[model samples]
Target: MNRRLILDVDTGTDDAIAIMMAGLSPDLDLIACTTVWGNHDVDTTTENTLRVLDHIDHSDVPVYRGLGKPYAPIPFLFPDYADSDRTIVHPHDFPIASRTSDVRATPAVEWLVETLRAATERVTLVPVAPLTNIAAAITLDPRIVDAVDEVVLMGGAHALGNVTPAAEANIWHDPVAADVVFQAGFERLVLVPLDATHEAIVSLDQTRALRATGTPAAVAAAAIIEQRITGYNEILPTGAADTAPVHDALCIAYLLDPAVLDVAPYRVQIDTVSPLSFGKTIVDVDNRARSAANCHVALGADATLFNDLMFRTLSEGR
Candidate 1:
């Protein structure tokens, strides 16, 4: 039996790769892919999602646009660059359009609420971006907490942060929304943070191998990586100069094969106050701050097996 899954993405470079992985998986019946605002604007992310699906000949997957901003009003900053006026950080950069596409008539949060309410089987929600839409849906209908089977997301960081000295980009973008979702206390919430994603690095050689797959998704995946990769050069871990971490793809890989990740329970809190650490995810590992474990934080992964799955997923529908 195929598990029903829904992808909530911001459609960044890794998000696009993860989209292909989810759309092509034989073990999963991808019901829908909802877009959010994180890597770029919701419009651009939604467009990129459709392009990826269409390029892979899976355009039938209904793409919907989610929240455009965080719950509380704040200065909207583009990922990797701050903008007080909320202008386009990079006009010609990624999330560039490959082909034109239209979004669904319904809002993402509305669809989310209705879908969960109507589903006979518990749905597996994979959120690889900020938790704005998920938060909204939960706020609209709290019953989704029980309706959702698992939330395997790619956000937060255990020891190190990507956006700032104390926050990962996804959780950092909308800590208020992240806080809402985390505090709701889903029974099976697995957070695949940067700590685990960094371990699953895809190097230049592996990217070359993926590009050689000759599939449209694979070719576009290679191009997107090459185009948006330079910005991450300074953040690449030691001995990974020619490699990039497939952050969101690792989360989907975990869903397909649990053996790819190593997780431990942790009590987490999101910092909503404090301008310096607005979107910081405070993880309690040693029981110093919190009493019970609310979320399962992934600390490590089997990079070898993850890369194999990524390549295999990208190699399909040729």
Candidate 2:
């Protein structure tokens, strides 16, 4: 049976690839896409989500707009790395085509609460952006936590941080929201963080194979990934030439095949107060705190498996 899933995204380049993977994969039944504020503004992310679905001919999936800012006011202003020319984080490379689908009138949080509350079957909540929308939904209706089967989010870091010296971009964007979600007591919470995503790098050679498929989804994904590679090489330097980590897409890949990642239960906490460590995910891997594990943190990823899945699914566009 196809797993029922909903994706909450901020429509970054990696998030775009993830949306395409979820929408195109036959293994998943993508019920809806909820857009939030992260890599770009909410409006840009929403429009980018529509463009991706339209490009892949999956406009049938409905989209709903969510919060435009973090749930709580951030204490300090982080550097706008996305605005820097060296980073080039914006996902504006997609060809501008006439949008066929529009965001629903109902707010994303409202729809998420209602859908999960009324669900008769299991539904996986995949949030590949900041935890704003998911945190809002939980606050609006705590019962939805019980309603959800699982939450596989793409954020945080175990070893090194991407945005700050101690934080990843998604979690660093809204540590308060991430904290709320982590403490909400979901039965199953799987965190696919930078530790694993960085390992699931997609090389330029792999992207060439994706482009050779000639499918619309494959072509678009290739272009987006190539852009990501260029940016990573310029800014982060993934230690590999002509390669980048499509972080968000790895979460979708994990849903399709559990073996794609190796996870271990850990007591995870988010730092919302410290200026130097804000948004840092403090994972207790050694049980120093001796608290019960609240999250399954992905420690490793199979890049070969990820590449195979991306090539197979994106090649056969929906």
lDDT of each: 0.81, 0.90
| Candidate 2, residue 132: lDDT | 95
State residue 22's C-alpha deviation in candidate 1, in Å. 0.2
Candidate 1 — which residues are off by over 4 angstroms?
75-97, 234-238
Task: Please give, for residues 1-318, the per-residue lDDT of candidate 1 as tens digits.
Answer: 888899999986888888888888888888999999987789888887888787777878899899899876654343453332112222235543565556899999999999999888999999999999999999999988888889999999878876777788889888888999998869799999988988887777777888898877777777766543444554344366766677898988998899999998989888888777767778888899758999998899888999898888878733
The true-versus-predicted C-alpha distance at residue 169 of model 1, in Å, is: 1.0
> Distance from true position, residue 304, model 1, in Å?
1.2
Q: What's the C-alpha lDDT at position 195 in model 1?
A: 88
Give per-residue CA lDDT, model 2, range 1-318, as digits (tens): 989999999987888899999999989999999999988889989999998888888889999999999989989777855356323855455543557889999999999999999989979999999999999999988988887889999999989898888898899889999999999999999999999999999999999999998998898888888998888877888898999999999999999899999999999999999988888999999999989999999999999999998888899745
Worst 10 contiguous positions by lDDT, candidate 1: 82-91
TM-score of each: 0.91, 0.97
Q: What is the alpha-carbon lDDT for the whole of candidate 1? A: 0.81
Best by TM-score: 2
